[model samples]
Target: MSTSVPYFHHFQKDTTGIERPVRFTFPFCYDPHELSILAAEQVQTYLAGQNDFIHNFGLMDGQEGLVIGKMFGVLVVQDQEGNLGFLAAVSGKMAGSNKHRYFVPPIFDMLDPEGFFLREEEHINQINRNIELLQKSAELKELRENLVQCKKHEEQILSERRKLHKKNKAERKERRIAQQPCLPEQAYQELLEDLIKQSYRDQHHYDVQKEKSTQQIKLAEDALNHILDQIEELKSERRTRSSNLQNQLFDQYHFLNARKESKSVLAIFTESKNIQPPAGAGECAAPKLLQYAFNHQLTPICMAEFWWGSSPNLEVRKHKNYYPACRGKCEPILGHMLLGLNVDDNPMLENPAADKELEIIFEDEAIIVVNKPAEFLSVPGINVKDSVQTRIQNRYPEMDSPLIIHRLDMSTSGILVLAKSKDAHQFIQDQFIKHTVKKRYTALLDGLISGKEGLIDLPLRVDLDDRPRQVVCYEHGKPAQTKYKVVSIEGKNTRIHFFPLTGRTHQLRVHSAHQKGLNCAIIGDDLYGKRADRLHLHAAFIQFVHPLTKSLVQFEVKDPF
Candidate 1:
């Protein structure tokens, strides 16, 4: 640590365009990596003292609980020249300074009502409100709707008049042909003429009404179009004004790089491929830490982000555990900000699965079932190349087309089915698609469950921003169903049996974790619950009618935990 830094000055220009010294404590400068190690060690020591969890994770019965909330830490660094800083950020959220006295304040302090940025934001919001109002204006809507209704009614009236005329004409012709000749020729001609005149009168009456309706409708439509044009013109003007203001606001958001040079929002993003600034550029914890350091001329060393709140129901997070920045949110922005800094790798993907032998439970010429160990992927995935299929291919060098029939979560352990022949694969796959294949699993729930047994039907879809994780959404998700029965209950835990009626990604884990379903995640589920040595859920049993033999087959494996 440098003893030289007693104090440092940092400033930001307000909405009034006045640059003034910012009032916040500057973190002490140190080796970033060294600082990270020290901070993590300190956090670890503190966690060890807490009874909320056990330190020995990844061991069955050795580690027994979870701690809620994630924490973020930073190690301020200083270079020899100390030109200082760049703007950057990490994934997750910030622990606000107001809530935690030891924490740093937000970059813009948006909560400050008197702040210039907040005022500007309010102006932008007002513009948005006006645009919304224009879109839903009742007066404009009524005018357009009335025009549409009038036009439709006129068309219907015209068609009805024409149909009646056709019917009358046919009737008149029928009378002329069926009845013997009328009284006198002149009288008959006169009667026919009269009949034609009556038809014409009906047509004329409706046509007059249609013309009046059309004229009124046209007037209303013209008014509506004018109003629409005015709204569009206003919207265009607002967009131009908004764009200029936003561009100015973005320019004010200058970030520091490792070399301690400031770059405006426009300069940084526009330099590379003309991408627009991310919606929330300088708001994240990493950026705030970096910005604070650079403004105060502190060296950036090493930093880390950890989740501090209750884990989101769908995404995996452990309180106090260190993690990497989310790739989707932070990568591009940080790529521009950390132009020269030597950033560390993401700690999450560092642990790749090693070669584990496939546990073959059953094998036939048509089909084979194996018990896949947890941490091994059912099939190859991005960043996960060595999977069950690759291992199977190695073992069965002579195997024919598409041996894999079904899959399991990489973190889940259980029975995995594989086909030896293409015909067998199709037959078994057909059974799954038809819901004829039945599978049962055993899981250890994190907490006591309310129900002894029940069916869970949840619609699940992938969370695109966060890969590999699935979310339960009724609107866009696919149908997933599971039947669970309580097997036993232990201290702070419940044992249960799950019979899945439909197969979906993370179906069992999501079914257990989602609030609507079991409401208790499987114990040791890192993505859904707390991180542990292994995910406690396992595929224990499976049954289906044989494709080749035309006989039913059921296979069950004993639960390891």
Candidate 2:
């Protein structure tokens, strides 16, 4: 607490035995370095005993306000004098303030009373209030109701007129048909002329009535539009002001890289994706940490981010568990900030299945079944193009249809069915689409499950902030259901069978890891759980009607682990 630097904290315990990491941590996906973990442990210890703050993390009872957990980060940094220490940061504001005595300050503080953000925000809020007041006014309400009634009245009057006109025309037609056979030629002509005159009179009356009704409706609509126009003007002004303020704020968030080069948030995003920076782009823990390190002349060694307190309702977050920096917000920011520093390479760029081979389990003229190895891609990916699909297409040059009928996660090893012809593909793909294809996956869970068998009905969607990682989102997610039966309990791991009823992306993995489902992560699930040698998930059995013979066919492959 008494260091020369306000946010820097030296290690309380002896650290002579631990070696410093040679390169900085990769923010997106990483295992926390030992030093980074130690720094985080110390920060957590301070959080436990602190009395200066009142944020409700939902860790203890009787805490006031919303139960929002936070992502805390630790950056292992060395000072200008080569002193080993670390800096801590929270993702956003803590206890409604950006300045904490023990943590690094935000890249830009929008909460400052003298700042333009607050002043402009207040103006926008006033616009909102004005719009709300006008919307709720009795005059506006009455106008809206009057317009509705006017429309109804117009419809009723027009309907009656049309009905009467139709009836009169039908009667005239009947009279003409009956009179034509009985009356003399001159008499029939006179009768026809009289009927025509009657029809013209009816038509004239209907047109006059229609014009009157339309004018009434138009009058009501104009009255409503007068008030609505004012409201719309205010809304348009508010939108323009809000957009300008956001752009100004983005400009104010200047970030520094290891090379001492500076760039605003707006420039960084513009250069990267040609889009405006997302809200809270520069406010993440990683950006704040790197910004402060550069400003204070601290050499960043490694970094780690962890969640503390209760998990979010839609996303899975465990207390005190390490998480990668979000890709959506921090990827571009860090891409600029980490320049000139020797950061670890992104692991996603490396193909895990580059050296692994795809084993053919069964094959025929119409279809091919392969025992796909773990860490293999079902199809070509962004960085790596070598996959089962590519290999199969190369092997069978004469096959004209898309080879993969079904897919497995790159980390998942299992039986995959491929089609040789377009007809075969459609026939089998239809079965999967209709949920008629039965599949069973074998997975080793990191934790023991108590129940024997149960259904997990958690919905899933891709975490927009982190690609490829799915979160449980009821509002926006596709239905994902999995039935699991525990096969055996081995010391600390539970082997289970998963029968997925829906084929949503990462369905089985998210269902197993989510707290609402099994509350256990699949072993070696790097995206949802801790990293290990390989993901312990396999498509062990599959059953479907053969596309060629229209006969029930099944395939089974034993899992390696």
Instruction: Using TM-score, give the best candidate's number.
Output: 2
lDDT of predicted model 1: 0.68
Candidate 2 per-residue C-alpha lDDT over 341-396 given as tens digits, one digit per residue, 9 for 90 to 100: 99998988998887888899899989999999998899999998989999999998
Q: Estimate each model's TM-score.
A: 0.70, 0.90
**Residue-wise C-alpha lDDT for candidate 1, range 1-561, written one tens digit per residue:** 233333221112111232212221121111234335444555445444545332233323434444224435554445346522122232233322222333455555544567665676677677678768877899878987877887888788778877887887788778766542755878777777877787788778777877877787788789788878877876787788777766766766777766777777666667753777766666666666666666656666556555554555445555554555444334545565576666544433443567577788888778888999988888887666788898888888998759889999887899999998888889999999999988889999999988899999988998764456688877889989999999999899999999999989999998897767787889877566655667899999999988788899999998989
TM-score of 1: 0.70
lDDT of 1 at 404: 86
What local lDDT does model 2 show for residue 553?
98
Which regions of candidate 1 fall more than 4 Å away from where they truly are? 1-102, 105-120, 131-145, 156-213, 226-278, 294-302, 309-324, 334-351, 445-451, 455-458, 489-493, 514-523
Each model's C-alpha lDDT? 0.68, 0.91
